[model samples]
Target: MLVLGIDTSCDDTSVSVYDAKENRVLSNIVSSQYSFHREFGGVVPEIAARKHAENIDLVFEEALEVAGVGVKDLNLISVTNRPGLLPALLVGLTFGKGLAYSLSVPFKAVHHIEAHIFSPFIGSEPEYPFIALVVSGGHTLIVLVEGFGSYSLLGKTLDDAVGEAYDKVAKLLGLGYPGGPVIDRLYREYDGKYLELPKPKVKGFNYSFSGIKTAVRRLVEKGYPAEQVAASFQETAVSYLIGKLKKALKETGVRRVAVSGGVSANSLLRERLKELDVDLYLPPLEYTSDNGAMVAYVGYRRFLIEGEDTLEVGALARCPIS
Candidate 1:
């Protein structure tokens, strides 16, 4: 069955078509509003919401065009409905509802984080009973996935997310807008061993980046080399992430591991995680962020795993897939 997914969880407006039986993405399109929010140093809710209201149609149209199918051809309609910026979410929900009603198809509301956990299956087959680390701009979470839509939270941030840490450090160093990639590139120029950044010694499957964020600032002001400081900052941040991730794996006893969200797009993170010698999955470069394709794919799997949901499914600004 064909499921159409719509996503406007934050700065990107995206649409995707997925085939439940085949477990594949027929077409996925994303319209990014990064440039509009770049100068502001972060996303502005009002501007992002307004842009999503305008771009949803164009993004959906492109999805159909790329998939070689129209709205009428879809068997189910789905949109992200929770755990996102409220203003950004309403646009996708409103558009998705209208399309579902007009086409008389079942409408499903999927959680944003759930969609991220399921994103790896966008192009490949899925593996069950694994650990999924969801690291993005606003969230950092570890989930022990037992099956489709069946997961238990293993760990999460006590304060700022990993992505936010990267961004903050980047801004301090005069780097570009999404901080992780730039910090990573600049890290190659410095020695990570130089700075003695604090590592949040949180015990057992929990994470804390608040101290690291503060420590980086103090180190920079104390005459640390710019390049080495950048390198140490990234290393410490990733070290904390990897530390908790490994802890989650041990606690859950699941070697099959995967990660998703905008920060997962980082080259260094991917490289580090790949060395684990476990069955691992990462989204295609396009699926690493908030894209409609992941939503559609999640919707497709949901319908099959839990059966078809009524079009009366409620819209939520916060929801739990489990």
Candidate 2:
């Protein structure tokens, strides 16, 4: 089956063509609006939505062209319609619905987080009953994946998501927007002593990064070296995440683990996870962030199990996966 996937969940306008029959992605295209939101030090919802609206069509066309397919050849239309910026979600959802209606193909609405959970298995089948750590700008969650479309919410962030904390800390250090990459780079470059940061004492599997963010703010105010601050923050944050994951592994006794989302692209996190004594799955860098390939892949899986949705389905700004 040929599935066209569209995802405008946040600052990225991504589209992909997945060949389900062949179990492969034909074309996965993501047009990021980082330049537009950089000046603001973070994503502005209105700007993100506007950029999605302007870029979705062009991205769609490019995806099809790269995939060597036409609209008439598509058998399914999958789109991210929930748990994202409302305006951005609507742009992709509306366009997807219209295209589905025109082509008389099935329209599938996918949950953004659920797509992230299975992103690592885009071209392969995922093992059942695995633990998933999904970290992104808008969400940070640890979920138990029983099977396709079957998820158990193990834990999530009580305050800012990890990526949000990274951005906020970067802003405090006068670093540019989309803090993860720059901060990660700085963390790798710095050789001096690192600033000490506090790890949150949240019980269970839940996480809290607000305290650490504040710690970074105080250090910056004390005129600490920006590189050391960034390095320290990255180390502390990644360690905190690993600590929680280790606890989850002990509690659930699930040795198969998968990590996904934008924050999963962190080099430090990847290195830490690789050291764990368990089967680990991490998405390719291109699929680490918001993208249409994962959305399409999950949509294909859902369609096989639950069929399609009606036109009455609408976009949602907040929705739980389980």
Best by TM-score: 2
Which number leads on lDDT?
Answer: 2
Q: Tens digit of lDDT per residue, candidate 2, span 3-73? A: 99999989999999999999999999999999999999999999999999999999999999999998899
Compared with the true structure, what per-residue lDDT tens digits does model 1 show for residues 1-322?
8889898988999998887778778988889997898787778899999999988888889899999987789999889888778899889988998888898888888889988987877767677898889898888888889888678887788888888888887777667677777777887665447577898887677788888878888877887766887888877777778878887777677889878988888777888998886889888778888888889888776766676666566556666545
Score every model by TM-score. 0.93, 0.99
Deviation from native of the Cα of residue 110 in model 1, angstroms? 0.5
How many pairs in model 1 have backbone atoms within 3 A of each other, for residues 3 or more apart or on separate chains, i.e. clashes? Answer: 0
In model 1, where is the ten-residue run with the lowest total lDDT?
313-322
Once fitted onto the true fold, the runs of candidate 1 whose alpha carbons sit more than 4 angstroms away are 189-193, 223-225, 307-315, 320-322
Give the deviation of candidate 2 from the true structure as CA RMSD.
Answer: 0.7
